[model samples]
Target: MIAINNLTFEIGARALYDEANWHIKPGEKIGLIGANGTGKTTLLKLIVGDYKPTSGTISKSKELTIGYLNQDLLSYASDKSILHVAMEAFDRQNQLHTEIETLLKKLETDYSEDLLNKLSDKQQEFEALDGYNIEYKAHEILAGLGFSDVDQERKLSTFSGGWRMRVMLAKILLQAPDILLLDEPTNHLDLPSIQWLEDYLKNFEGAIVIVSHDRWFLDKVINRTVESRKGKLTVYAGNYTFYLEEKSLREEIQRGEFKNQQAKIKQEERLIERFRAKASKAKMAQSRIKMLDKMERVDDVDDDNPSVNFNFKFTKQSGRHVINIENLGKSYPNLEILDHANAVIEKGDKIALIGANGRGKSTLLRIIAGADKTFTGKSDTGYNVTQTFFAQHQLESLHLESEILQELQTFAPKHTDTELRSILGSFLFTGDDVFKKIKVLSGGEKSRVALAKALTADANFLILDEPTNHLDMQSVNILIQALQQYEGTFIAVSHDRYFLDNIANKIWYIEDHKIKEYPGTYAEYEEWQNKRKLQPKTAAPAPQPKKEEKKPVVQQPTEDKSKQLKKLNQDLGRMEQQISDLEKEVKQLETKLADDSIYSNANKLKETNSAYQQKQSALKQVQQQWETLAEQIMELEA
Candidate 1:
């Protein structure tokens, strides 16, 4: 566990964290969330000692091990195979294996008892450390992260930055440190890999703090949430959804207190004025003034979630059919991206094209956007189909000499300055941030500017590839809301499920070298896909065994079946009741922990937190049991 006490960190003249305090408990999963420039990643770096705080201390036991995975690791290059790079986490076992090999070679000439004993010791140590299985473990993790068996044997330097980041992740996961600090772990992962990581991290023994913009991922993995705002860290007792509700409630209370304090101040000021004019009450008036001056004033809450009324004003509407692709065949020398793939995009169709990496999502987007002409099939754009395509490569089109506000002005010339600024603000460029030159912006910043520009185009159709890549949760929400109000046709390629579910009416995926369509939202598509996977596949029937030689039917006893069903139903009922009771207890404990008084009393806070966590664990166990029992009852009945 690590404790950050009164931590203060500054960049240049601005303070990122001002006396922020947070304690990371053992075995706890925490989601550190905030806007883009807030200090989520900075806190992780502070814990790992990569950056030092200006004041206060991050305390932990000397023996505690830490593993950090950040974007900076993308520059790490090695000639060794990815498997070898990951297996390097097992230092002791690898050393023992080398020693054992050396001893075996020495025995080929002089077979001394000392050499034999040394070899035995080394082998024993290696086996004790599970050295032989390390490679298997490494391979399993790498494959789970979307690496093929053949790719594992290739040199790490041969992979791209994104793939190399995956290799770094594999190495960090293999390290199995006491606490894992991941900054946007899902940024480089496709949908399948993200789900695999979610499952793996749920079963991970160590504590983890994830700094991510993926709201769905946080909801699936984190038990607690921490927000960094106004140079202070505030704890939310639950995940991202819970934090939203809790923060709203807290802000309501804060607003009420602020109003009441303002009224009280007015009353006190009137009384002081009335008494100050009287000779007899002069001393009382002075005392009242002192009291009012000493009172702690409550500050009103700021509206961080702004409502946008800026509409996307395009010049012309597209025809009924936005795009039409026929027998689309595209391939490279060693890879076939698409073959005889055909799809139709109609107007008003907000399509979400998604799949694992190495698929043809981007290529298809390019073809639809008319940026690629190498395909072997026909791709036509509908009438009056003016379009704007947004991708990572689009950043090159931006004028580096222009400022953020100036960049928006060029693309959205019809809009007022205030409207353009509002759009930029929604993308997290606020105040003087809009004045920064495009040349000085980082990749993420440039992505935001590009996305803002793309969304403001006068075209009737949009083709977006990974628009949510660099957006924070709030910015993504903004984009979702904007797209919801958009009347133009669009086809977007993204792995962000929340974004897809909120924006798209159809799901597109590539299968069997042909484009497939699911006429539903991403959530509905996921549910259907899951049920499809669970449905039993039909098998060929066994040859009718010579008419009368058929196997006799094995009939189960009615009494035993009835008893088993009854027991399962009874157990399920009990589990449901227990789960309900535990849920109440955990809620009550959470309320107790939320009290300001408890924080002032350390012992009370610790005891309440411990009880809350225990009840949560118990609730999870009983809920799982209830599910198992219900499944059993269903199977028996069937």
Candidate 2:
């Protein structure tokens, strides 16, 4: 348990927290939330002693231990395997294992009773500490976080930053500290991994304090919500949805009180003014002024909800079919991402493409955008379809030397500066912020600018890949509103379930190298998928015992189809295992792609690109095989 009493933390002259109080009780799951720069992460650090408060105390019991997971841990690197890294959490067990190994070597030489006795004692301690099962525990946690057994054996330094973060998270979970302080833990996680974490944290025996902008995650995982706003730590005795309702009611009550107090203050001032003009009533006015000065004036409630007004109009209109894909085949090394897969994107289709990481969601987005033309298939756009694409990588394309206003001006030559500033304002950049150079802006600021450019492209079709990355909750809401009001067709890949649910009318997911569609919102898709998964499993009929004399026999359609489908699925599973390796390799290559040393050099970039293409080619070949096998199964079923 930890108690923060009258805590006051300051940065320079500005107080990030003033007289804030919070008590993290045992087994309490708390969601720490607020706008950007609200010090949510700082508060967690304060609790973990990373930062000292300007005043007041944070009290914790001597037995309390904490496991903090932050963005900084993404830099963690080691030659050791991830399994070994995670096993490091079991300090005593690991120490005993080392000591036991040393004793075994010693006994081979001395063979003394004293040495044998020490070895026996050490073995007992190790067994009691579950030393033998430490590796298995580490593997289980890593698997839950989306790592395979083979991946656990790979060096930690070989993983991408996101995967490395997962390693650190696994290490923390293995530690089983008394409390967990997770900062944007889901930022690097895919949907399946996020769901796995939700389940794990739901049953976690210790207390948890999570700082994330993911509304759906908070609503599902936390029992309490703490808002770090207006330099105060406000507590809501419920989850995010409950906090919204309760905050609205409290604000309504506060508004009434504020109005009443304002009226009383005006009346008092009027009386004081009238009495001051009269010499005979001067003493009475003086007394009233003193009383008014001492009065406790109620503060008006701040605006909690801000509206966005943007009319995204395009000069051209797309045809009935926005896009059509046929016999699409894409691969990367051993990963058969999409093999002869097919899908159609009709006009007005607001689709959310989501799945586990490395599922080719981003890759598909690129193919749709025509940015990557490596796929072997037809990806045709409808008539008069002017399109815009938004992705995390586009942030690097911005002119760092240009001001925010200038960047938009160059991108939207037709729009006036005033109109551009208005668009920026809707994204929470106001006045002088538009004048600041893009180079000086933070990642979130650059993201907003990039998004603003994408919206003003005057395109009827949009292909957005992870557009919500680096955006805060407010910006996400603004995007949701802008997309809601726009009359355009778009497909986006995102892990933010709340954003997807609000903006998408259809869900698109890739499975076994094929793109599948659900004509419903994300929530509905989840329900449907869950039901499909929960369907009762029955054993498939075995092949009729060997036919006598090699005679041809009629086959049962249902049983034959089931057998074929099962075989096809098993093949897909084997391919997926191979994909695990290629996925990691591709991620490593991508991490290299983001490196300045590689991209800044033409030769190195060319070499990396060539190697990348080779891997992709290999993956596509395997993916094509998937289509071959799948087609056979489909034929048998037909």
Candidate 3:
């Protein structure tokens, strides 16, 4: 656990945190959220001791181990297998393995009590730490993260940067430190991988503080929220949605208080001016003047800037059949990603394309966007369907040497510099920020620039791939609202369930080389999938003597099924116990909270309140898991 006390961090003349105070508790999951340039990553560095606060202290528990996963992926030049890299997380276990091997060799050479004792100790420690299961767990985690068993043995250097980041992430999760600090851990992950991480972190025993842009992931994984803003930190007792509501109320209250104080000051000033010359009232006027002078001015509340005003100007409306594809087939030299695919995109259709990674979602988008002509498919756009394609790597298309303003001008050649600046401001780039070179901009900044340029294009149809990849939560919401209002037909491939749920009117789910169209939002599609899963199976076939002889073939599957059920039952028991323990702790905290004297101490009150909330959150999570397991057990029994 770490405590940030009166922390003041500054860069040049800008104070990011001005005497900000926050407490991080054990076993609490917190989502660190803010807009770009709000120092979320800087706070993580401060907690990890990589950066010192300009003033004040970051006190940490002496025995706590903190694991930090930075945005930069580890680059391995050596031929270390991916599994070996993950296994490196357990360095102590590896050392014990080596010691035990050496002791065994020595015993074979010459028997000695010392060697025997050393071997015994090392073996016991290894078994206690589940050393024998390390490799199996590593593979299991890798598979869950979308890496195949064969891929685990491949050299780390063979993987893409995104996949390599997964390798690093797997290692960090294996370490299981006391506090996990992850900055944009979902940046490189696809949808399935993000879901896997959410499940893993939900059951993680230690504290977690993650800064992520994925709203659904944050909502599912974190119990508390912290916002970093203009020279201060604000803590909310619940997740992102709760934070939004509480923050709005807080701003409203602050604004009201400020207005009231200003009115009182104005009244006092008028009274003083009117009574200054009256000798009888002069003393009273002076006292009122002193009171006004001593009153601490209320600062204006901070809020988001005006929402970006965005509207799509269509060159021409597309025909009813906006896009039509027939017998679509795409393949590499050794792999056929898509085969005999067919689909149609009607005018005004807002489609969300979703599937596991490498399932041809992006490839299909490319074919439809006319960016990939190599595919064997009759893909065509309808009459007057001008399209603007924004790929996942679209930011790379920005001219790195050009300023943001200049790039915007390139797209809108007739617009004057003043007009360009106004448009740039709409995308949250104002003042000198527009003058920054694209090379110097952060990923989020570049993403905004790409989006701005995309908006300036003369197109009626949009094809976007992972459009929300590098955007912050606010920017994503902005884009979502903009798309909602746009009249153009669009197809977007995104991992953000929240965004898709908000904007997608139709779901085109890609799986096993085919696209299945569902006419509803992502939430509706989820309901359909759940219902499909719960349908009963057909009756079993009648048994025969020859079928009995084939029992050996099916016997292994039954044993594996039994093992899985046993594990689930064990997990259920553990969760039940955990829920009971957390309930007790919550009661204890509530008792302490009832002590009115603690409210007088600001630090004690904050700590006690945070502890109680954390306990309640932990209990809720455990109870949810318990119910989930109970349902699964019931289904298995049935």
Q: Which candidate number has the best TM-score?
A: 2
TM-score, candidate 2, is 0.85
Number of the candidate with higher lDDT, 1 or 2: 2
Q: What are the per-residue Cα lDDT tens digits for candidate 3 across 191-243?
A: 78888899999999999999988878999999999999887888999988898
Between prediction 1 and prediction 2, the one with superior TM-score is 2
TM-score of predicted structure 1: 0.82
lDDT (Cα, tens digit) per residue for candidate 2, span 221-279:
99999999978999999999999999999999999999999999999999999999999
TM-score of each: 0.82, 0.85, 0.80
Candidate 1 lDDT by residue in tens digits, 1-638: 79999999999999999999999999999999988789898888899999999999999989999889999999898999999999988889888888888888889998899888888888888888888899999999999999999999999999999899999999999999999999999999999999999999999999999999999999999999999987899999898899999999999999999999999999999999999999999999999999999999999999777655678878887755577677789997898999977676877999999999988889889888888999898897765688999998888999999999999998888888998998888777889999999999988789889988988889788888999887777778888988898899999998899999999999999988889777789998898787666654543343444557555333335567899999887886677557646655765776676578888888878888888788878877876786677667755764
Error of 3 at 52 (Å): 2.0
The top-ranked prediction according to lDDT is 2
Candidate 2: stretches off by over 4 Å: 537-638
For model 2 the local lDDT of residue 278 reads 100
- Backbone clashes per model, in order? 0, 5, 0
